[model samples]
Target chain A: MEARTKAEVLRRLRSVAGHVEGIARMVEEDAYCIDIIRQIQAVQRALAKVNDLVLAQHLRACVTTAIRGEDPEERERVLEEIVEVFEAAQKI
Target chain B: MEARTKAEVLRRLRSVAGHVEGIARMVEEDAYCIDIIRQIQAVQRALAKVNDLVLAQHLRACVTTAIRGEDPEERERVLEEIVEVFEAAQKI
Candidate 1:
């Protein structure tokens, strides 16, 4: 719920987008192996922060609701989604 | 932000917590291999939904902020975090 925090996240994402594009360029230009790897690593770090922010929000909001709500279907769907993400995350 | 959506997320999380605890129990009891694996897989799925929800929020809020704000530190921190998460996810 930090409006400012949300804005900050977005700004960082845009910068990351540029770096990603740079990675594509490096590949096209046949950049050095380490350089490419370094860029990839940079992308990874950027994603981690985004991950933290999301997790924080979920704990604050989603987790709060699921406890009080009586609808099982909604709860199930959310549970299913979490599993999906965790699985996908494992792959990445 | 959908207030209702937040609530739903919480409910799902509680159920997942139960499942995770169950997995711990299975480990202690030396439950069937398949059963333990299945429970771990289930946990993975639950994490995924939370991931998506947070990502949506980031795109909506953080990305928007970085675009408008002049602060570079906030942006950098966010980017760094993303990369960290991405790497951790890879390990998982």
Candidate 2:
């Protein structure tokens, strides 16, 4: 990944870490159900942003390599890897 | 996104299109059940790779923006969007 992109991801992750900590604090304080739910949602959103970043990187790097490679096996392998990640994400 | 990354995604997509065509041919020719399953698996794998690429980008851009923005609303919006996408993805 490019330096800028990497930096962006790291920055986001740092924020997410803080957000998650907030959620933990809320839970500890015996926060109301709605309040807890809201915090959870915040964390989920942060995670989603991270997920998007990773997906873009794979598309640019792995997918490109697979498509341009002369070796048929490489192409198939990359495709397989991509599909696998999607499947995993779906499960999550 | 950078030009190289964009090019990579496009290239991968092109190959996937070809792969899908192959699968269509297999189905058309009354291929064995196993053969059809294999093709489906191949398609799934290709899709997964693409998903990964997109996820990476979101983490880098959207997540970073949310974290850095001073507005609390922007941060909340980004987080919500991320969770929503992941939930949708799971359903699929």
* lDDT per residue as tens, model 2, B12-74: 889989998988898889899898898888777777677667765654556545545566677
TM-score of each: 0.47, 0.50
* Per-residue accuracy of model 1 over B1-92 as CA lDDT, tens digit each: 56866777787788889989999999999999998998899888787666566655554356335523567676455545544554466566
> What is the TM-score (0 to 1) of candidate 1?
0.47
Candidate 2 segments whose C-alpha is farther than 4 A from its true place = B1-92
Off by more than 4 A, model 1: B1-90
State the weakest 10-residue window (summed lDDT) of model 2 chain B: B59-68
lDDT of candidate 2 over A1-92, digit per residue (tens): 87877999999999988888888898889889899898887777777767777766655556555545567687556556644555577655
* Native contact share for candidate 2: 0.23
Find the candidate with the highest TM-score and give its number.
Answer: 2
Model 2, residue A12: distance off in Å is 0.8
